[model samples]
Target: MKEQENIIHISNLEIGYPIKGNINNTLFNNINLAGSSGELIALVGKNGIGKSTLLRNISGLQEPLKGQINYFGKLKNSYSRTDFARMVSFVSTEIVNVNNLSVFDLVSLGRFPHTNWLGKLKPEDVNRTARALEMVGMSSFSRKHINEISDGERQRVMIARTLAQDSKIIVLDEPTAFLDLPNKYEIIHLLNKLSKEENKTIIFSTHDLNIAIQEADKIWLMLEDKIAEGAPEDLILNETFNRIFEKSNLKFDKLKGDFKMQKSHHRKIGIYGDGPHFVWTKKALERLNFMVVKENESGQYIKIEKENNLCKWTLIEDKNIKEFSSIYDLSIHLKLQLKN
Candidate 1:
């Protein structure tokens, strides 16, 4: 494959934690990477894998046991601290404490590399900070203190700070860890927009596989024994990725993009009709039983109905027709019947 004309080249990278008795410990090996400008890349792996370690190595916070990172045709190690700061900025899972400082104050620190010795903001700095705040939708809360914000809000503030740095590449470690589903998507969307609109490179680590596959321009898959990197959908569709995260017995399903497990007891249920009918019926059955199977039940007609500007579903049990608006409500009714 031809190398991207404008890429930040990182070669032969190896990173691991230090230890005395654990002499043979290492995370990954011989990693060569190039992130292009205006691309969104995702770094993903199991929990104990070295995703953060790689990010820190590139940020120069931790030195790799062996390797080199070149930024704009210069060795990363050769750049002065100020020059390094000017080249890239970072956001991690670490929480900050600037109790009295408002959002603008926190973001203003991103301009320090370009500001005077007294940390006075130039007009350019003001414009950049304002734009960053507005991009993250934190402009309305500019005066709000960091200490008095939600985790999701704090996250946006941190991204705004990285934007204020005005660097070519921004590295974030699990920016969506603290977010719930909606906030998670929102933050990812904001980062993607920033990368395209500002023509900056954005790399972040995340456990959100579905979003990663749908959104990332590139994906770096870190496994226990080997590492895989490509476009998010490419790595996913090539059958190289596996599901690693789980809940209480919620095993990963690489095919359906959900969790599945064996049934304690199977469901004796019949489904009829087509289109939306099967969806709600399947949902109701799944919620009511450990496992649901479809067969022709002798007398019940659980089928579809479409009314004026609405979709309706009805069940004919014991020669009576009962209607429902949502599958979840149907599930609740089925759950009651299962109990009895």
Candidate 2:
């Protein structure tokens, strides 16, 4: 497969806001990164990190403290505001005051950079706006007032606005901040689809690290001390998350691709089976602070077997066997046994 071309590149970039009198407070420096077309990149970090500031610098909303950024082979600082708007579109977390403006009207605002001084929407502009609304699955609600829609709908509308702008690169700052679980996944899925289908570069800052780990083509992990950028699996394999979120009580589960709080277990449980039932049974046992082992040498063992559509779980101890039809029932039995 051919490698995608780079849309934006940053070398030795320093990012932060300026201080009035004292030295400028810097969050990160010496950053080197590149984003390619048809890619979905997630900027993930803990709160108060510089994910937002880095996005701002890349999108040209603010000047970098030092170093250089190149957008489409041109200097980032060289483009006029209007010219830059044609290359990159930004969506912020700030709620818009939608006083009676319809969704279509809101999306059409993205075309203002290309419009004449009168800001009239040409036929092509109107068509592009409609397409953008459709792209985000909000075409049916194009005529609805922005205030009449839910928070998730508003977020989709904002994304549609960026689409209508026809920029090759799109940047969003915490777009899923106020959304529900399903909506958050939906928005990220939509962005992933758009990046592949539309061949646009989509970068969004998010606190949802799990979703980013699962969905993003590339992850830019910002830590208090450094920044690491790579494919999600590469970063995980390199144990980058472990280093970035180094904590005594936390462990990153490579199998589950999630972080878990360390727990103390007073008992160990042996499990037998090699299917979904066994997997879930192990999970349930672990939740109760029971360590799982493979062999029955521990004397206490749980066996799971599926016959036809029904599954049976049996507990064996001291040459005695007790069976239960469901894992829930088995769990209840274990709780009682542990208490005794």
Best by TM-score: 2
- In model 2, the clashing pairs are none
Local distance difference test values of all predictions, in order? 0.78, 0.89
Model 2 sits at a Cα RMSD from the real structure of 2.9
The C-alpha stretches of model 2 lying farther than 4 A from their native spots are 1-6, 305-312, 319-326, 332-340
State the lDDT of candidate 2 residue by residue for 1-340, as single tens digits: 1245548888999989889865789989989888898999999887777889999888888999999988887896688878889899999889986689999999999997889999999999999999999999999999999999999999999999999998999999999999999999999999999999999999999978789888899999886677889999998899887765664667788878888877898788899898788889998998877999867658889888899999999999879999999888988988997899
Sliding window of 10 residues with minimal summed lDDT for model 2:
1-10
Residue-level error in angstroms, candidate 1, position 213: 2.0
TM-score of 2: 0.87
Query: TM-scores of the models, in the given order?
Result: 0.80, 0.87
List where candidate 1 sits over 4 angstroms from the true fold.
1-6, 21-24, 243-269, 287-340
Model 1, 1-340: lDDT tens digits are 2344344777887787666764635677788787888889888887878899989887778877777777775787688887788888999889987769899999989997888789999889999999999989899888889999998999999999988998888999999998999999988888899989988889899988778776788888886666778886565566666544433454546676544653455446566656656765676566666344454554555666667777666766777878878777667776776688
Clashes of 1: 0
Query: Number of clashing residue pairs in every model?
Result: 0, 0
Task: Give the Å shift of residue 52 in candidate 2.
Answer: 1.6
